[model samples]
Target chain A: MAKSKSRTEAPQDASEDVVMQELPTSHQPDVQDDASMAEVDAEDDAEVEDEEEIEDDTQRVRLLPGSTPTAASFEFLNEGHTLGNALRYIIMKNPDVEFCAYAIPHPSEPKMNVRIQTYEGTTAIEALQKGLKDLQDVCDVVSDKFVAAQKDFKKKSISS
Target chain B: MDYDPMAMDEIESKGPVIKISQADTVRVKFELSNADISFANSLRRVMLAEIPTIAIDLVEIEDNSSVLADEFIAHRLGLIPLNAEGIEELQYSRDCDCEEYCDHCSVKLTLHARCTGDENMQVVARDLVPSGDRINRVLGTPIINESSDGLGPLIMKLRPGQEIKLQCIAKKGIAKEHAKWAAPSAIGFEYDPHNKLHHLDMWYETDAKLEWPPSEYADWEEPPQEGERFDFNAVPDRFYFNVETAGNIPPDAIVTEGIKVIQQKLASMIHDLGETEGGENGDYNGPRSPEYNGGGDGWQDQGFTTPYGNGGNQSAWGGGAGGTTPYGTTPYGGAGAGNGGW
Candidate 1:
């Protein structure tokens, strides 16, 4: 994937996004990028995150393979939360994850694909549900802190 | 965890989904019936560390007249992942009985450079020549095929007043011993199955009574029966797989090679088990290929010792250059010099 560096950067600055960033992995990425390494092998795997299908409020999860509790896909339509990155980060947190990765299949589709891989007894769907719920818990804590910060700012303004 | 992988039959299962983005990288999604996390974990672990490939383990620097230190050049040379085709034809040095080197064990590469003219010049990987007849320098891409994109990374630089000569020995080994011989730059699989959509809203934004798998993913021949979509909307147990190469080997070759290694290891284990159990139960008829001894230590020793080849040898043609003789014997040996840099 010809991922431009600028594409992976946070969208705070328009022109600041110029470098593609690699997804974090269990091993250090430095040794892999040897200076003498042939450039052909340096093709970046990252992609420009699609910011279209993002809705900050809506969250959806669809069970795949019909009724089986084996697999599931979580799609965020309008929330530009970068859930794939978050979910992949969560998967990495689990040393037992069979497989985990994020994909933005088509350039026209703004949806992120967060797939969970499990085997034997633990179904991927269960792991996915757990991850989503855990993420929500983290978000709730962040939301509370934001509200507290707002109240503090308001009090400071009244005193001034 | 309770299921035995060996007992499981290859059911009439669906094919794996494959998506190749570049020549060096590929993504695959497939299902494993009657298999568990243990099996998947083993495959991933073996592919990363057990699968064998060629690497420059030892370097002989006869003369170093360049600005860079001797170890620096040697380290850089070891890092270049050679084109690993026909790797199955080679043998791990530990398994080979040759004292110094042998055709079946190691391939020799020589780099002899000197500044001929008064003008300033540079030396590159194009100067290092692998005994072409004995070893393949990976096909479809040359060692120093520098393009506009600079996909061809440089090996070393030389000056007009400098001169250098050394012999490099390439041997078969796994990533556990050193990263130079690692199978893939990146490899991991996830569960991704062909999911079927129940209703209209469960799929795309279309209202029409769509067919199973809809139309975008209509590659499947036989669509699901009426009232049942292929669950094209949700795939269970199916996973996304990715594998990248370090330019020496293609992504597909590395994947196939990795699988081959895993199969061999499993087959050996099964054979060893059958041999020991058959003696007690009578009539053991499992395919016996990689023979194992009657004790636990033999198996464990085989598992640990042979994987890493003999390292730390800097002999200057002293018990070294095991397969160097094959170079002159091959018709292409002399011709290899004309192929790379002058």
Candidate 2:
């Protein structure tokens, strides 16, 4: 289940189109050069982002049985949304979700950087649905990159 | 508080103190019509109610169940369900309950060992119950929960041929010091091909919570071993129906459909027995056996209408029915035309 960190960064530099072209061989792509490049980019992004307003957009929720939402301070996110607007809209719906600022490219939708955050004990499916609904409910959302997707059990189980 | 050097030394010398040690038991003395029904469910429920802990480690396979040979076989061989009942023992993870012994909660081991051992052992409960400890080892894992102080990890070993026993001790409470024991509740079944009615009875000895009026005819007997032919009529009302889950097919499964129907009826009978209320013995005090019905003539009404009729008057697998044979005559009566047919 464990893969070398060195082999998972080439496509990060390549645009979604380039990555898509290499999708067939994505599983075993060259990672040494890409990983080093990713490390450098991450460092650069970290410095710039630390200096700027620290917009903690990341959220995480424990997927468990019989967990309910409490003290709503953060909203959910989903697909079909204007970029920045969805994040802000989700925050409005759930005023309780604290921002950690960890964002990653949506696995299916590369154009958008999806923020990952945590929530209280709740089913992964329910949490994702709520996040998606919130993202779609907001108006005047923008799109430098806008996409939403929930974690799927199939992918997690297979990979793990 | 005062401390005694000698006492302290004694305590230290007893390394890895098994403060909470028990042997709780659940003996299911039962009777059932040799029918094939979901008896496995009943076995599971009884195990759960009693053991409540001890993660099942492993189950061995032995024999399958069959309806032939006038006997019943368990579902599996060796140990049917590897992790059947052992979760509770893991919960007894505390000190002794006595003045310093284990008490109400601690390391609990639940064990369920069945007679039959040749079937695919299904996992009925997996860490189903937990301990009442405030601190848990694994958090966020499927088995352990951090919120309520009950769920705890289980680490114990169990193998085949051993009487399945779940033992535990109280963690910090007074109950920990006290040793308790439990055995699997006894269960049995019987099938009458003639009446086509399966009769089952399940019994257990419990603290005097209710009084069970005893029936003079409280016929309890031991079940037959594998491949043994049992006089279905002679099977008492309360015998252990030894079943195998793997090695050999239980004699009861030979007549699959009949046994299945009988199993359903037996399950209901057990439920009824559980619901019976009265006395501490779990049985009411009354004339033991039913009024001795004169001779074997009344056997048909009692659900044993086979070619040889009820087993009361016959011996060994019914002598192929009573026939009027004068001088060396060929057997030509009842279902004897062919060697079998009920």
Candidate 3:
């Protein structure tokens, strides 16, 4: 039965291979036509490129099933030096995204608040989970230094 | 002491509210009563003061209490928010002994004279004159006789940046400076600051599921202003917004495409879960539908075992937990026409 099955598959696979191999080579004349039709085809190619990117992303996503993704944000609240540093980091990391931002002057506070928006697409629930995990990792790496900085900012404000 | 121009009892027949639409024309209104003639003359001098207001287009408010309004008032009070450094440099040389004024000092003069007299001002620099010579001298002082009871008029001149330091001259009933002069010099509307966050609010409104702020009403009501166009393409599905300011979190940032890919994978898994739940028959236990091989004859209910052929395993394609293969023997198709006779 297995021999018969292999024999049945062999003839069918051979025909498919022949068809696949000859189709492109047989269309050699079409290549010149493709060149002549380049401008219109270029637009088609761009759309195809976009689809290919999405397809690649879909394949990658399928491999990591059930994994949550999160967004990493950098806030610039009053500390110009830290903000400049954070902005530099973002620019370095996400060169493709156009960053839109503006400053809001705090009524009594001595400094301005700079708000920035970055575009990313991951569901909020997944993003939240990832964000929490990232926060944990950040906290661990700093060895509670992050907490200490917050306390310092608070103390400075209160003391002043 | 200038009379309050905004005071209510002042008008005999209120003058038409002269609305100035032309950008070039300077509009000055004297809300003076028929009795207050001297105050009207004081306004002309204040208008001539050389303070300039700088216009900046801002997006958000740091202070909503209208400090800009106060700045305007202070302008009327003769205080000006200095323009850039160049103008400040110019103020130092408006009045000087040199034919071409130099930085030692310039005398800025604002004269509010209604009583009809010429007041020549002398501002002597320390370098040009000795210690006793440094003085702010009013050349001609006008004196009204006793029974007239009315201050014949008022006069005050000022240097740029210097406040108009003139008191209201008034008799028992006749008040002039107080009735016609503005308390603060208001810079034109160009310098008025606006909110920036409204830009985001408009973006949200373009596709928002939730309501934006109250200011959005005015924005929606008005036509599009320059540099302000709504971004209609930013869809809710394509973005995830968070209130980073509310918590001690990072500000708005977009995750990378890899993160979205992970999200799509998870979504697919959920879809698969639904499909598996739907495909599962009532065995209630065992590997799920995608893995379950229920007595495969393709017609196991009809009492045949091994759907593919003799001695073949009941599992389709015979692998443990392999993903569903598309060309598996469909349970609906009969093996042969003679096998299942309805």
Best by lDDT: 1
Global local distance difference test of model 2: 0.27
- Candidate 1 TM-score versus the reference: 0.42
Worst 10 residues of 2 chain B by lDDT: B14-23
The reply for model 2, stretches above 4 Å from the true place, is: A1-3, A6-160, B1-28, B31-36, B43-50, B53-342
DockQ of each candidate's interface versus the true one?
Answer: 0.01, 0.01, 0.01
lDDT of 2 by residue, A94-133 (tens): 4233332223234454232223233555322233344443
Candidate 1 per-residue lDDT over residues A1-160, each given as its tens digit: 3467556443525422221221122221234445434445334322111221122112222221111223333333221223455445445344345666666655455555555656557755456544444434333332343244435544765697
Candidate 3 residue-wise lDDT, A130-153, digit = tens: 322332232232223323433554
Write model 2 residue lDDT over B13-62, tens digit each, in one string. Answer: 31111110111122112233221122222322222222222222222223
What TM-score do all the candidates reach, one by one?
Answer: 0.42, 0.16, 0.17
Q: Kindly report the docking quality category of candidate 1.
A: incorrect
Candidate of highest TM-score: 1
For candidate 1, what is the lDDT? 0.48
